[model samples]
Target: MSPKKRFEFAFPDIGEGLAEGKVLELKVQPGQRVKQGQTLAIVETDKVVADIPSPRDGTLVSFGVKEGEIIEVGRTLAVLELEEPDSGGGEAGMEEERSLVGNLETATSAELPPSREGREAAPAGPPVTAGTTAPGLGQPVAASPVARKLAARQGIDLAAVHGTGPGGRVLRKDIAETAENGRPPAAGRVQPLSTLRRALASNMERSNAIPSAVIHELVPVEELVALRRALNEGRGGEGQVPRLSYLPFFLKFAGLALREYPLLNAAYHPQRQEVEQFGEVNLGVAVDTEEGLAVPVIRRADGLSLPQLQAEVDRLAAAARGRTLRLEELRGGTFTLTNYGAFAGLYARPLILPPQVAILGLGRIHEQPVARGGAWAAVPHLPLSLVFDHRVLDGVYAARFLRRFMDLAARPQELLLL
Candidate 1:
């Protein structure tokens, strides 16, 4: 007979460039039985909200972090009690870090330090969210970490605040609205920036450092509109079909144009002072999520059919909104596209994401009066903005690429054949 030893389980490295995550939730409480692969916590990184799972089956002990606090990788998340009947060594429960979304690279127990109690005595702590070794919400509340932090700062009761976020989760906006009418804390108090905001600040600082330029065009797309209508109709061959958006069409043409001008599909290495040209068209589509901006990559864009592009766009967009996107999905983009038109934006000189040299911004399609063959007519026009890193590409090269893409997009039916 052997006594069960408590082991400290640390958070594993989730992915490259991913360092810290806010503990959005705790799934298990102290003294609760847990199984391998069961979610221990819902951690929100700057990229996504991941369900971090337990590696070995054991009884739950306590957590080292609070719900709203930032925890770095390799930090111990929870302690677990396990009986090592066979090993009979100091290391019993320590194993490779497990995750519900993907497996972390911690393949051996050597990655985690031994329990402070020497894998013998039980861990000391209370069951709750961010004090030292805190207990988690056995059942989590439907509220984001930002909302929780905001409510605490303002001394607003969360149970009364109406949540407008998806699934009725309280968001920061919801908290702000409550403050506008509640008898809470004083106004104009400084608030901590959310994880997403901090990342955005870093990216904006990098973007400001780059010398960029933008070129815009308003091209009539009556033919393109008719072509899209036909494609949507073809989906059902009859009555109302899904509104296939203009983005997939725009992106498809963008890929074809990139094939003609390969330099547009390239990255700038500032430190190395060199340009890396790409033969493949991997479009990074910027999606606005509840957390913030997320750009997921669509690999081999030139090879995928329009329908395939639409499917990929839908999957990635949904993953971004739900905070389920993996780290790899957010990297390796040679070029980027942003459809600001979805939000009624007429046009924008969108900032270029780092390394990638070019970005195309699309505004919403609308009907405007235009002269065709000396006749005035109301026609749909797609607004386009091509922003490029001046160091990697000159205006002439970018303009040529944009013109080629526009020409291809106008002939919507022709794009399908290619």
Candidate 2:
């Protein structure tokens, strides 16, 4: 008589040197038949939430970890009763198991193996709010990932938005209409901070420890505006440049300005008691997302052309807003740029983030009266602010860097030469 065949699926390494993650959702139950490559669960590690797939066709005998439990790599995730008996050739079976082990290590950022039915695999999208629902919370409402993200961003209640999808699932288009039609905002109430918000709070607390000083200036950007207008006219089409913002100009100018003032592109290590300067300019762009603030880095910003920089910025910003940035994209930034101009603020005292000694903020560009040719004329001016570690930089150097930066910004012709 043949023995019962069982296969234990362990939580494989999901890359990023992450050793542990919290199980967000369990799709299958005990005694349920699951096909190979079917999504079994969603796991979140270090802010990266990804869907975990079944390794083989089997009946889910039992779940090793309950939802909301943190699990480490190599820990058994589930025990499955195989649909087919194990072949008598032990060597071939072991080889097949080894291949499955490798497949388990893949992440949303990587090209995943094909699924059994070839469904369009959804990549790691928006973040799911963490922590278990309170007792009697009525079995957590179900919504599509896009719908959840849109609702969160628009601050609309998911329950209030009528779902038109199958089984009353809220669709993205419905959420958009709800946002545009001015749905009633939620009443003010104390609520728990989300996983991403908690992390940001901790980081800001750490950042507050640094002795920082802020300085501001108004950069005349008439030429910059004209240049952008000219470029857009030349394109002659909508969405020719996906996300053509003033950011790429700021990034390019900052990189050039950093070359002249390398001290601004440096970090300070308190324990080492030394300032480390970097030749390569890795710019961290602060992106405001539904999940809180995310700073995705642009490596070697000094080398990328204006168009390339625009593309990279658009890609990272999309990923960040969509909640798909990997761990590496969030770290190793030598300098930071925060563009509050996109929203509302006119000027802000940006804070220094961690080991990085400096942060630059670009505020809204406004038309103001200026003395030109002995006559008052309205011209566009960008509000600029720079915050730096007091221990590493003095006001004099900061003033000098700002002067050079503004000069580059004023002369768009020169900036393009770089």
Candidate 3:
């Protein structure tokens, strides 16, 4: 053996405050040839499942960490022998130019070309640079380990599923949606909780430590509905203008209400046994993704207009699902909003995320019989659930906050002006 020379790629800071990640998969073995930017493994952090790509064209020597092993930042992931060995520049010099966490691009939907085997082919524009889908090319079908596992259990080949993720990457949602359409759910199966799921469970457990109270109310939203419809009509184009919905209205109303009742938008300092009220409103919007729930924050939401807020919400939601959200987008949320009503729920006693004293859940908007002009008439009503930390806010204060929110929600057009 001509002097053993190799390059070791260490895990870098994949996300803000992410100290480590669990190795969920390994895409190459010893002696296997991997192209630069090809996926080498799948790593799962608390926030999302991210693909780890090879830093250079090389032959894999060995992986430092095994599957399901938690590796901390700055730890070597793998060693590889470069195809073109440097004569003067040593391994240290070559490693300095490589990005360990690079090539992890977001998946975007593209028109699938004619199938080679009656299945949707990869994008037609050009060959994928990050991860390959063709056999003998590189890794086959870039997807999260969870997505691949689910596809295997369903007897569905990943290539057949349409990928809407960045660079035509297949996602867990794509697999789950395909499985639901092709085969019914099996009686049951035992699978380990993902990092995202485990993190959510732990957070929920922590939330239970806080004594919370939930207050339910029904707000008339006929005016809100009409306002939204009219606003959308003027600027209604798919993926163009921000789609107006009752959500933007609710968010605006909540922010305005928070200004008056600052207590509702505060974090509790348990160590000091006091409430810490924030000067700015950083609202967390709970988004459901294939991995799990991610709350991306809208920084200083109070300063944003209805249109601006709508666009930010849309961008954050897309980023959350695509696993492309940054660290700052995931933190510093003074308050939270979860819309269970979007799934046809009447109301849900939403849990208060620890430290944050309150969380508001929006129930389904539906037509119900309400007294109008002293007569029972069918009108659209919105169900609102306000859950607050009892230590920080009394029931009366919580009720008052809701009343202020409803006062703004009832006059939806007025909010549009703001």
User: Who wins the TM-score comparison?
Assistant: 1
lDDT of 1 by residue, 176-230 (tens): 9889876444444455566677777788788878899999998878899887777
Q: What is candidate 2's TM-score against the reference?
A: 0.69
TM-score of each: 0.73, 0.69, 0.68
Question: Candidate 3 lDDT, tens digit per residue, 1-418?
Answer: 3444577888765654466777755767679988876778777788766667776687899989865567887788888887554566676565654443332231212211110111233333334455433322223555555566688767777666776654455667888888778853443344456566777888899898889999999988888888788878847666667567667777888898899999999999889998899999999999998667899999888888888888899999998877777666888999999987988798898888778999999999999997778899999999999999999899999999999999888886666565
**1 or 2, greater by lDDT:** 2
Better of 2 and 3 by TM-score: 2
Name every residue pair that clashes in candidate 2: none
Count of clashes, each model: 4, 0, 8
- The superposed Cα distance between candidate 2 and the true structure at residue 320, in angstroms, equals 2.0
The C-alpha stretches of model 3 lying farther than 4 A from their native spots are 1-20, 25-42, 51-64, 72-143, 149-189, 238-240, 416-418
TM-score, candidate 3, is 0.68
**lDDT accuracy of residue 349 in candidate 2:** 85
